[model samples]
Target: MLERLDDIDWERLGHAYGTAEDVPEQLRALRSPDAAIREKARWQLYGNIFHQGTRYEATAYAVPFLLELLADPATAEREELVGLLAAIAVGYDEQWLPDGLPIAEHRQQAAGGAELLAAAPHPGDDDFDEDEGDAEYLASLSEDDQDRLYTHVVVAAYDAVRAGVPLLRTLLASEHDLELRVMAGYALSWFPEEAEGSLPVLAGAVTEALEVGATAADGPDHTVLAATALVAIGLLGGAPDPALLDDRRPLVRWGAAIGLARAHGPRADPAVAAELLGWAGGESPSDDRVPFLDGDLAGFAGQALAQLGAGRTVETFDALLRRIPAVSGVEALHVVGEALKLAFPGGALTGDVPFDALDERQRRLVRQLADHEQVWRIDGSYFGNFRLLIGEYGLPDKYVTLRSYAGQG
Candidate 1:
C-alpha cells in the first residue's frame, strides 16, 4: 500500500484544500502507536479529504489506502479505519442524518450520475452556465478527466469499495471489537445483496444490546450501536421486529419505526409509523433522542416525516405538520418548501394545477409552512439548509430542497 501511495500525484489532488500534498502524512498517522494521534489523523483526513461529508477530488485517491489499513490485522484502530472507509465510500452526516444515502440508492445514483458535476464555475469563467448540458465541459477540460464531475469521481471510487464487499462482510461476521462489528454490520448494509450476512450480525448486536440494557454496563453504548445496526438492517431491506417498539430503549423504538418505514416504503407498517408519529412529536419523555439527528428530536422527526411523506401516505404528512414548533434553525424554510413541493410533486412545480386542487389536509400543510417563511426570510434563519444545498450539489443537496411549489418559487 505504501509503495502504491508513493506513485500517486498527491499534489494534483484537491480536498477542502487546494492540494492534498499532506495526505500521505495523515495516512501514516493512522499507524501511530499513540491512540490520540491516530484519532487526530483520522479527523484531519476527514476535514481535508471529505470535508463536511462532501467528497472532494482527493477522496477517491485515499480510498484504497483507507481500505488497506482496514485489511491489516495489526492495525489497532480497526474500528476507525472501517468507519473511515464507509465515510469515504459514501459519506456520514454527523449533524442531521444518521448517515448518507442508503447503499443501494447511493450506488444506483452514483452509478447513474455520469455527467453530474459538484460545481462548474471555475476560478475564471466569463459566463458560467448552470444547466446540466452547458456546464459539463467546465470539468471535462481538466487533465485525464474521464470523470469531469466531482460526484462521478466519488462514484468511481465507490465502485472500488463495491468490489471489496467480501472484505467488509468478513469484518462484520468475525470482528470481536463491538464498534468494528457494529460498523461493519452497517457497512455491509450498504450493499443490499449482503443482507444474508448483515442481518444476522445486526440482529446479534440487537440481542447483545438488549441484554446489556438490563444491566447498563455490558458494553460501551450498546443501545446506540444496536439501534444503528437496526437502522442499517432496515436500510438493507429488513424490517426491525415490530416488538422493538415495546423495548425500554427509546432509540431502539425510534430506529424500529423509522427503519421499518425506510425498508418497506409505501407498504410501511402503519403500526410502526404510528409509533414514529408519536415519537416524532416526542411528547413521551422516554423518547429522549431522534433516531439519527443531533438536535431536537421532534425537529428531525419532522424532516424524516416529510421525506417519508414524499413517497408514502399522507399519514406521514400528518406527522410533519403536527409539530412545526419542534422544527427550528436553518432547516425550517427548506423543509417547509420540501413538504409543499413533495405534497404535489409535479402539479405544484409546473403550475399546471393549483394548490387548491389538493385535498384540504395536504393543502393546509402547505399553507401552514409557507406562512412561516415570512418570518424566516426576514431573520435570515431560514435557508440555512438552502444555501448548503446550492453550495453542495445544486440540483439535489437533500437538505433545503426548495423545489418550486404551488405557484410559488
Candidate 2:
C-alpha cells in the first residue's frame, strides 16, 4: 500500500486538500508504528500536502498532528523538532496551542539564536550597551535550544525599544534563516523610529516573497511583516515610498495606508488623503463596491483615515456615515466612528448644526433616523456629538426634515 501510495498521483491530492473526509488515511500513516514511515507520512501530510490546501483545512488537519509531534518525547533532535513545531504553530491560529506547550520554550529558542549573532563583533557595538544579565540568560540555554530561543526572542524583542533597534539591525545584515529574517522585519513594527534605516531591506523581503509565489499563507507573512515595518517607519514621521501603496496585495496596500497616516502632518499631501478615501469608499460606487475591510486591514484603514484629520469633506463625511449604518456589529461601528472622529468629527452629524441647537422638528427627524437598531447604541458617545445624534435618530424617513436643518447649520 505504501509503495502504491508513492506511485499515486500526488497532484490529485492537492485538489482534495480541504475536505476532512480524505484525511483519515493520512492521519493513520502519520501515527504508523515504523518511525521512518511515520515521519515520512507526517512530512507528506504537512509539508507537501497540507501546504497545498486552503488555510482552514490545512490548519484543521495539520494542527493536531503537529501538537502530537511536539508532545511525543521520542521525537529526536528536540531543537529541530521544536523549530519545525514552531513553524507549524505559525501556520495555525495562535489560539489553538494547548495550555502547557511552553510559549517560553519557543521564545527561548528564538532568543538564543539572536544572542549568538549579537555576540559576534560588529562595527556598531559601541552604540549598543551590552547587558550582562541578558548575556547570561542566553548562555544558559543549549546551543540548539539557543538558536530556537534566539529566533523567538528576536521576534519578541522587535516589539521593544532599546532591544529591537540593534537586534533588527543585526538580523538584516546576517545571512540566517529566511523565515527568521522575515520575522525580524515583523518585529520592527515596535520601533518605528528606527524604521528609516530598515524600510528598504524590509521592502526587498516583500518583493522576494511576491516573486517566490505562494508556498503557504505563511509565505505572505514576510510581505505582511515588511509592509507593517514600513508603516511603522511612516508613523515615526518618515516619508515612505508611495509605490509601497500600489502593491498587488490588499495587505500591502493597507500597510502603506497606515504608514502614510502616521507620516501625514500639518501639511500632508492631498493626493495621499484622496487615495486613502478611495480605498475606504471602495473602488466603485455600486452596492457591491465594499472593499475588503476585515482583520488588520479594516482597523488600519479606519485608524489611518482618522489620522488624516479635518481634511475630509462633507460628501466624504456623509459617505462614511452611511457606511457606519450599513456595517454590521458594534466593532465595525466602533472603527467607523473612530475614523470619522479622527478625520471629520463635525461633519459626521446629520445636519451641519450641533445636536443641542436643532429645533423641535429637526430633533424629531434626528430621532426618527436613529431608529434602526443597528445604528442606535448608547456607546456611540465615543464619536462625540455627531455620532451621538445618529445613534439617537432611528428612522430613515425623517432624515429629510433633519437634513434641512443640518444643511442650514
Candidate 3:
C-alpha cells in the first residue's frame, strides 16, 4: 500500500529524536504479521515522531503513510493508528477545547513563523551536540527560532493529519467494530473545518448507534458509539439530536448534555447544564472509561463546566467541593485542579495570611478542604499533582498546614 514510501528523504527530516531515518522502517513494520513486531514499531512511532504530544517535522511526513496503513484492510492496530493521527493533529484535546481549535490564529502564526524562518539564518551544526536529538537541537535555538520552528512543524503536522479526515470518515461505517467507529468519530471531532462533510456522517453514525442500541438489547453496549458521535457533532459546531439527552444510558445522556452545552453555550437548555452538573458531581461513578475526555466522565463534565465559563460559579464550586472527598485516581487530579484554579485565581493565597484576610470564596474553599481531610490523607502518589497545583497557588500543600491556614487546626 505504501509503494512510494522510500521516495521521501526521511533522514533530512527530524522527529522527537535526532533524525527520522528510522521512521520508514517503523512505518513498514506496522504491516508486520507478527503482533509483537507491529506493537514494537507502534511504540517506536509514539516515542519518536509524536512523542508526548509534541509533533515534529517528521510527524507531518508520517501522516500520509499512517493513513495508508489505517486504510489497508489487512493492517492491524488501525484503531491505535487513528488515535495517533488524532494526537498528532491536536496534541491533547483539552488544549484547544471549550473554545475549539483556534484554526485562524494557528494559521496566522504559522504564516508569520514561516516568514520569520525563511529570512532567519539556520543554526550551524556546531551549535548542537553531536548526539543531540531534535528536541535538544530545538532547545539550543533562539526563542524566536524556537517559536518559529515549533509553529511551522506543529501546523504542518495538523494540516497533514487533516488531509486524511475523509478517509477517517469511511471508518465510521465499519459495522462490526464499534470501538473503531468510536475512535474514528473522536478523531474527526478535532477537525472543525471538516464539519461540512463530516457532520452528516457523524449524525448518521449516531442514528445507526441508536438503532443498534434499540434492537441489540442483548448485545454489547453501543452507548459509546452514540456518545462519541454526539460529542463529535457538538465539537463540529452542531448540537446533537435533543432527544438523546434523555437516553436511557447515563453516558448517552451525559454525551448529549455535553454536546448541547458546547454547541449552544448560554442558549442551551438550562436543564442540560444541570445534567452536566450532576455528572460532574460523580453521583453515579463508573469505571468504564469512554474514549473521550481522557476516559473520565466526571473529569469530562468538570472540564466541560470550565469550558462553559461556569468553573467559578457557586454551584460548580459546591459540586466540586462535594466531589473531592470521594474522588480517586488521576481523573480526580484534573477535577481538583480545576476547582482550585477557579477558587484561587493567579496564586492569590499566601502562607502567612490569617484566615480572616482571605476572600469569602478562598475561605470557603479552604474550610471545605479542611473539613474533608480524607482527600489529603489519600496515598501520597494520588496527590502528586494536587501538591504541585496547590503549591502553584502559593497555598499549603499539606493537610496540617491547610487546617492551620484555615484556622481550623
Candidate 4:
C-alpha cells in the first residue's frame, strides 16, 4: 500500500492550485490508497489549498477536514496539527461544526481538542492537567520548563482571548521568570481593553523593571515589553510622572519617551515637554558623558517636540536637526528628520535673517568663513560647498575671497 501510495501522482492533483474545479478531485484524493497518503493529501488540500479558495469552497471541503482534525487524537503531532486546525478555524470562521454532526458532541470534541492543545504537557512531563494546582505546578518548574509552559499558555491565550487573558494575567502577576513576565505583558498588549485592568499591574512590573536596572542590551524582547507596557499604560489614560522620564536607567527613559509620545494630550506639562525637547537637542545632562544616546529615545523626543510645537526657535530647531544626522542608523535618522521637518517648517539650517543684508565687512566674514585657509577650515569648506552649489554661478574674486574670509573667521 505504501509503495503504491508513493507511486501515485500526488503532485498532479489540480486542487494544488486551489481552484473550485480542483476541490472535488482533491476531496476524492483524500481517500488515497494509504493512510499516510490520505493524511498528506488532506493536510495539503485542507490546510493550504482550501484556505485560499472562496468561502463556499472552504466551507464545503476545508471545514470538514479541519473539524475532523480537531477531534482526532490519533493525529498526534499535537502542536503542528493544532496550529493548522486553528488557522483553518480562524480563516473560515468555522467556530461551530457542520450540520450532520450533533452540536453537543461537536462542541465537546472541539473544546477537548483546544483544551488539550492549550494545556499540552511539557516534553519531560508524564502528565498535564487543567485543574487548579496545574498552573502553580507549571509555574514552579525549572526556568527552561517554565518558559516552555508560558509559551504554550501564551499561544492558547492568543487563540482564545477569553480563556487566555485571565491565565496570562495570573502568569504576569506570579511568574518569577522575568522573561515570562515580559512575554505575558507583551501578549497582554494584544487584548488592550480586555487587559485594561492589568495596566497598573504592568506599570508596577515596569517600575520594578526599572528598580532592577533592565537595559536594552539585555535583549530586544525585554526592551520591547518594557516599552510596550509603558505605551499601553499611556493608552489606558494613565498619566506618567515626569520623574519616570528622567529615571537613572536608560531602558526606563526610553520607555517613558515612548509612553509620553503615545499619551498625546493638552495635559502634557510644558516643563516635561521642554525637558523632552532638551533631550532631543542633545542638551540632556546624561548625554554629555554617555558614549552614545538611545536613537529610539532621541527619535521619540523629536516626535514629542514636533507634536508639542517646541521646535519653533532657530536655536532649538537647529539643535533638533543636528541630532537627526548624528543618529546612528538610517531608520533613526529618518524618524528624527521627519519630526524636525514637521516642527521647523523651513529646514534645520534656517537662522535669523541677517541684521543688515551682507555688507562688505559681513561679506568679508562670509568669505573668510568660506575659504580653506580660515581658522575653522571645516566651516569655510561648508560655506564654500554651499556657495558653489547655491550662490550665483559667477561673482568677482574679491567677493568670493571676502565670502571665504568671512565664513572662515
Q: TM-score: which candidate is best?
A: 3
Global Cα lDDT for candidate 4? 0.43
Between candidates 2 and 4, the lDDT winner: 2
TM-score of each model, in listed order: 0.67, 0.41, 0.89, 0.39
Candidate 2 global lDDT: 0.44
List ranges where model 1 is wrong by over 4 Å. 1-4, 7-19, 33-40, 51-57, 71-81, 92-151, 163-182, 215-221, 283-314, 330-338, 341-344, 347-383, 386-409
Prediction 1 TM-score vs. true: 0.67
Ranking by lDDT: 3, 1, 2, 4
Q: List the residue pairs that clash in candidate 1.
A: none
Better of 1 and 3 by TM-score: 3
lDDT to native, each model: 0.60, 0.44, 0.77, 0.43
Tens digits of per-residue lDDT, candidate 1, 85-199, equal 7767666443324223554544454443454444444322444442332335645555434333555766766666666677776775666676676667656656666668667
**Candidate 4, run of 10 with poorest lDDT:** 92-101
Tell me the tens digit of each residue's lDDT in model 2 across 157-249: 222222334544455435234544544554343344455666666656555555553455443244544454455456445556677666776
lDDT of 3 by residue, 329-349 (tens): 565666777788778866655
| Candidate 1 lowest-lDDT run of ten | 393-402
Could you tell me the lDDT of residue 242 within candidate 4?
Answer: 64
